[model samples]
Target: MNTIVDFQQFNNATLEQVRTRFEEEFGVMTYFMNPAPRPCFNKICMSELHQSQTSLEKMQGEVIANGKVSQANYLVLASDIPGIFNLGGDLSVFGDLIRAKARDHLLAYAKLCVNNVWTFYNMQAPVTTISLVQGQAMGGGFEAALAAHIMVAEKSALMGLPEVLFNLFPGMGALSFLSRKIGMPAAEKMVRSGKIYTGEELYQLGVVDVLAEDGQGQYALNNWIKKNHRSLNSFQAINRAKQRVNPLTIEELYDITEIWVDAALRLDERNLKVMERLVRAQNSKVNSDVAHIQEKQSA
Candidate 1:
């Protein structure tokens, strides 16, 4: 997972070749580039660290570079992880940093996260950004999805900000983005509720842009792109206008992170224990998934 794969190498490859490259890059967390059916490219996330924010920072740079040379019409973010788009921020890292009172380290990580999310939120290039969520997208995962210009989720996919359970809130860009997507009141309720929602529910709530049948997320995404192709310019312009009117600046995100850091530091032993339990739950889910994959391969 530490090794960075050069995405440009497969830029001109055939669909099958791109698929092979994607599989080869698969590790604990990785991203692979694939040419979309349309005049665009896709960046698929296959990671354990909830979009692997560090790697995302690296990938985002490459994306910008590529866009400069050959502008992509769209930038789709999809997950290779089955039944789980992402679980969210690395709680284990948070717990350790909080226990050590490493405010600088926490802030650095938070900033890295914000940088990645902000890039998606702003669509660093002229391309339209899309998040295709096929499964569960929790906490920071949900925040990442919201960062996209369009969020396409499968009907059965689960999405939520469960940070409240650990006495924390999704401070990266959830509040700002969610408030923009859904009203501030609903956004506040979602952040404070600690409840998981189905894609259909989120779609109805205006949090999810498109809802597809189970296992049809990619299809839905492509359909949306095709349907909106003629109006892409106008759509993007409107989005930019929206941003101009109600900006979510990096400064705002950083300010919120400071508050998050302060809040994280205030967690009592009981709260820490609750976080520990969630960490265990995350690990257990991953382990079980690995086991299931191994069993299938053996069969």
Candidate 2:
């Protein structure tokens, strides 16, 4: 566990240069090769909203290329945050854009998000994508998790799309991915309910692929990978077949996003007030996480 994989020698200088390594407690490391035939772990540290999205897009490009050239069999998307996978869209930016009536800018952001999700959903490369959710994944965060070919979540983790609470919807592929996973009716119910479900609940609802015990997410991921390694080709083929049967097109997502932008623009003062409150909640969560890390370090 103490040893780090030296990626520079692999001639992937770009990845080596841009890859980030978080503190040990966060358990975040990106694009590190595992033992023979094991998938590479690509840690995604979701701290800032725009920065995280940009980073994820870049990671996706690298991963797609890496899989093609290096033949990396698996790619796991995980977080560096201890108790929060991602809080979702940048509410602060949303608030500003909405207030300023910047429809084009908002649409651009949504498109960027969809581009990343579309890439993951299609798995353009010959690699299987997995999402390891050890904590809360809300709104766009939940959509990101759903984009993966497989979702492995810890029992204590929570996932939900709370956009409806702020008088909006998760437009960046949430409806598309969730509907495909659990059917349209069920997906619509969950989105409108705005309720957060534990990993166990989602698993029972057939949304979560693997449910692991708390603090054992990494172990569970490794175990699942090992178990599926021999049948990887079959597993990947099944994923492809699933997509073919229920195709999720980029055009569909873009159309939904346009609706989302229009809805956002029409939000009344009360709705914006609620969104502002949610922004405060997100900031509070970030502060709490910082305090937790500080407490742990001081201990």
Candidate No. with top lDDT: 2
Cα error, candidate 1, residue 273 (Å): 1.0
Q: Per-residue CA lDDT of candidate 1, range 12-53, in tens? A: 322321221111111111232222221111122212122333
Which residue pairs in candidate 1 have backbone atoms (N, alpha carbon, C) closer than 3 angstroms, thus clashing?
Answer: none
Q: Which ten residues in a row have the lowest lDDT in candidate 1?
A: 20-29
The models' CA-based lDDT, in order, is 0.70, 0.70
Q: Estimate each model's TM-score.
A: 0.80, 0.81
Give the residue spans of candidate 1 off by over 4 A. 1-5, 8-70
Q: How far is each candidate from the true structure, as Cα RMSD in Å? A: 8.0, 7.2
Candidate 2 residue pairs in backbone clash: none
How does model 1 score by TM-score? Answer: 0.80
lDDT of 2 by residue, 153-207 (tens): 9998999988888788888888898889899999999989999999999999999
Model 1: per-residue Cα lDDT at residue 169: 91
